[model samples]
Target: VPKGVILTHHNFISNVRTCVAMFDITSRDTVLSFLPLSHVLERMVMFAYLYAGTTIAFAESIEAVAQNLIEIKPNIMVSVPRVFEKIYARVMDNILNSSSLKRRIFFWAYRVGKKYAARQLQGEKIPASLKLKRQIAHKLVFSKIIERTGGRVRFFISGGAPLAKDIAEFFYAIGLIIYEGYGLTETAPVLAVNRPGALKFGSVGRPIPEVEIKFAPDGEILARGPNVMKGYYKKEAETREAFEGGWFHTGDIGYLDEDGFLVITDRKKDIIVTSGGKNVAPQAIENLLKTSSYISTVVVLGDRRKFLSALVVPNFEKLETLAREKGWHYTERKELINKPETVDLIKSEIDRACTGLASYERVKRIALLDHDFEIEKGEITPTLKVRRTAIENRYRELIDSLYREESSVSSDDFPSEESK
Candidate 1:
């Protein structure tokens, strides 16, 4: 628990150099900085920006980033997935509430843009007719999306969490690519990152030039390189345990795919093993659920239980709008979500979202909370990652009630294998 991660000068310099070469950062580029510099990932990227003599402008606050984007017109930036998630939800919510004709046109352009992007990613030949259609699609839809981001974004570098594949592809269809990366505090915070042109949608990309990686017997990721931390600052015993056979134990569980790209399953300690002995990764389910505009956040909760369930936080702003339109009356958020109609609506949405998942992985029941998991309340980390143990402890009673229903959720609530 006390293994200190001390990054050496060489480690910091090497990571910065790798990023500079990978992105071809130059004096001409301007970066809008928002992530805290206390985070090693932002620290290294900031160093690289200074090394290349690129201009750095700090965002006044997280809420002000949108206005800053327009005012400064940054050429490149680094961010976590939450920013993208918010933008995606807002854009989708507007479309969902728009006129039928506009909705149809937007979706048509979306499909055409996705096809064009797919061809470009694969280096496949594009027929002239398809190219002509793509041009029309951009003129009508994609260009407007880019304008919302100040129309000068080159690309974004995302990390600190897993980015959903569909969200990454959505950006690509609109001509903005989010190149994702992966690492931990012990590895000077960057071990692998996707390159600009050679992008893989869900992967965190290959190892950096100076690092060597391998998987353990239990599938824990292991690394050895100049970039790896020296050792625990004062705890020799913990340091020894972290480094066995000269390889730093990452404590993260993942494996490289056939293409040598890292596919993180989940944290080694976070995988939930059901009572039936089936192993399930909660992050996969949570990512899919978060795509719903009504669901702002979710935590999968079926560890050692007969079936899966969820602790959900709804988008209150959207819910209020719906309540207004429906002429529903409520004085409290909790009372609002407890209505029979609201529960039915959320259940249907969950069923539709989980249609593609296996039976054992789909959420069987859910408890919708009026408020989100807040960092100040100790439910999440400063970086916004959920503190699972704390959240579980805080919501113990709510979670227990989900398992107390007399009957298991009906099959009709979750799609069958054939229906998928």
Candidate 2:
């Protein structure tokens, strides 16, 4: 069996191949490796380094990545979206916690820079004044944050979750090349990635140098290339179902842009078909909801129903701050969410956020969950992805109660409405 000596085995082969193809690491290159050896991403990079005769410096733990990064200052980095998100969040949080004048200046610069970057991504010709302002922002604000990311990070690749476009553009504006990629465990992983020089803000770049991609009539993405897996380990039927006419059938629904970049819409199975037969992609709606700092998670539900509804989990910290500012009495999470006033506040926020969405995709009703959904509770995956089926199963009763016309009770007060 093809094997690697470092990191976890999650998507090992693809990760290894990615390193070989992209970085072109040689005997002289040094890589600071810390991701779990059991994960395919890390394992592949480790093996690739070995094959290239490059020096490998393994960090003691994730806690030590920063210290190790400063010491090693490697030429390339591969990490999950969470790591980057935390870095962006920390920088933004620090600015927010700074003096009011400094915070205002930072935000003003950030907003202007972000708008400029968005225009650039759209291929609009930037005005000279806006371009000069962006340069000033890069020097005064964004560059400092990039320096904190070890300063030597030539390229940062994000996968395992959607890297918010704003975050991607923020890094780009700061002169850091943060490329987004798309893959799966079964594909031996690396199918498409945003190339270093040629990148897009919203799109996840084009298919990698060797991969081939096509779309099914139903819009599901189908892949074919050397990187694709042979088949499922022991599930022959599943393997057969996964490959259609020589193309590995990816359950994800997406389209290839005019320039051949892949833009994933949502999962085919995750599509919510309303009673009027309108197909709504919930991930789009969920992504829109998350843009609101107050919302942590949102699950849209409306399959075979008249309209879309959602269960939202608030960012408790932000919610609490809002509560304090508004002079609300509730302190506990449950008490806060169950309050009529809080419910109305969240409803207003939801309506505001979903205002631009299609009528069918708009969240018509919402129920707030008392606690954040966690993996330990089997509501989420180890990767922190929501297990949609598990969530629907766990909250069947609560969801039913929300839809009941006669029900006036809170989410916690509702009876379990599980169907037989």
Candidate 3:
């Protein structure tokens, strides 16, 4: 295995400089730093803040980030999609669980706010009636969401993991911007970032200054830049493989869209080549499923199998609330998760998420689990990334059972769509 990458002083400084320039971070800006300093992404951003003479407030812990955001009133921050996802889920849960009048008002205001923001982005002229409606919407609903962050956040620089488009849109709808980007530890962690004024929902923006990126024959991203690391420590063979033909092999499959923004499909090694020869990217499907408030964690499986299936971990709190409303009875956690109604609830969510996806990309079967993939269980990495091999090994029986049951059929087998 590759032990570690050798990043030099120049690489760090180059990344920090490029990052600060991207955001135009200034001394007036206050950044909330919650991610561990040991991680290259955080470390680079921290140094960039320092380089720009920006104020950095350390968060107490990962769990305390929400509270810290209000107290710090940060002008800019770095975060992964999980943070945004949790916030989105909480907001949706609150609105959905509220009174009928309040729910209607909240949703109505949300639409107006989104329309206003979209129009603003397009530089379209706003009519007086629409302007007044937007102002009312902002005061009635969007203001409360903004107040959660202490109302001063300019933007959130997101990376580490792919940010779901729906989650990004939710933030934008509330007048908050989440700028999603892409990179790995080996690339000093910031190869490309969505700049302040030019943000796209899904695509990671153009490469930073001095970085040259290209796609390989198989669509793997290859790069040659000052930000790239020298080599892996004491692993000559691995280093050679990493830097073959004078380019650093990123091991990520992606392409430059029409506008030259980088769009990551999935990890090269994680691509699932189904028995039918269709190459599917699990991350996209997994990200889509995780958009549902009920879903907490999802692992898509089917490398050499017939079709894709998933192991889903539901947000137990939301599920319990639903169970109460539906009058479902269960004594223990396992009993609750194994109940027929509970399974059907998860099935409905999976089906909704799979609606617009390609037939092969849709999850044919899913096993609902009460527990999340935990790092201590060796099912996930310390960074909270699911270890695919470890998960497959640990849940071998459950996964086999999903495929074994003839009852697990494609989304097409379900009844025609009805209004939600």
Candidate 4:
């Protein structure tokens, strides 16, 4: 159940002050506001922007963000990881559909850009020759991609979810900066954030001055600060439970890296302990799989099971194109997903994406769904976070059948597939 937070006027003011100074926002900056104002993250940020006298531009809708960006040409914007993931997927899909010569040119430019970005992140001075190559690459390939964001986005602020490391790097290579942050509504929504001159791709930056972070024995992040909410609104028991040790439990599992940057593993409740006793952080794997142009959404599963499996929702647009190119025949969505060619394609994508993961952490079986998970079905939340339990419950028979087939298959045999 979702409980209301009993926040005070001081809560917003303190967070707003910290945000203004933390980000160095000024009157000259204009921010594009897309997230709903009622969300604590957006509310506190709007307050901060207003306090700094920064201009705010309201997006017409999420679907209209691209047009709004071009019109407003704002200096800053904030969004969840989903937005970046879609952009990455769309761009990759287009590249895959382009001519062979264009594909080669894009890849060459991408490599040069990636190398240049890596050096900059390491604080190594760019050589003049490499700098010249980077400029050419920008003009040849990245400039077009950059134009989609209006060519003037100073930086983007990502919150509400963890931004995938690959997506962050890709944006950097294309001359865009995504500063991912971590927070919750109860904390007035600002904890740690990546800022200019103090950048890291994969990790959320150090905790803000107002908030204090610590970890529970199980690695749950706990926070104590003036910005923390007083308690749940009229839910005293829940409030007491949340602050059992005088620290508000964040329920997120993460740790501070060597550089003091926070690296979120997964949600404490979502950690899967297999029958073999190996603990798996599903979100990281799920995020990795989502980077594939073929996968629209996925949920990794194997709680107390022999091996990991997944429920995949294919990017039908890409899938159909692949089918057409390969001469695969299908009359409808269901028939399309079950075709041997389609199954093999998705399986290959899963394997390609998880090549670096340990054996147990990798998905060993998959069941493909023709349609994406829907909020109306309770398979995903409004923000697109998968509702694992709800999904598993709804697909229990299908999921169980996967492991059942797994048990019968020889151990030496590789992964299996199912279609739903």
Q: What is the C-alpha lDDT of each candidate?
A: 0.85, 0.73, 0.84, 0.87
Task: Give the clash count for each candidate.
Answer: 0, 14, 0, 0
Q: Write the per-residue lDDT of candidate 1 for residues 55-116, one digit (tens) a residue.
A: 99999998899889888888898998888888899999999899999899899999998999
Instruction: Give candidate 2 regions above 4 Å deviation.
Output: 1-15, 24-39, 49-76, 82-100, 111-132, 406-420
Of the two candidates 2 and 3, the one with more favorable lDDT, higher being better, is 3
Candidate 3, residues 97-145, lDDT tens digits: the string is 8999999999888888778778876778878887899889889998999
> Candidate 3 clash total?
0
Q: What is the overall TM-score of model 2 with all chains considered together? A: 0.81
Query: In candidate 4, which residue ranges exceed 4 Å CA deviation?
Result: 410-420
What is the Å distance of residue 156 in model 2 from its true position? 2.3
Q: Per-residue alpha-carbon lDDT of model 2 for 55-135, expressed as tens digits? A: 778877766877777788776777776566556655765776689998887887888777787677678999999988888
Q: Candidate 1 regions off by >4 Å?
A: 1-3, 405-420
Best by TM-score: 1
Query: Candidate 1: lDDT of 370?
Result: 78
The top-ranked prediction according to lDDT is: 4
- Please report how far candidate 3 places residue 272 from its true position, in Å: 0.9
lDDT digits (tens) for residues 14-52 of candidate 4: 888987887889999999999878888888889988899
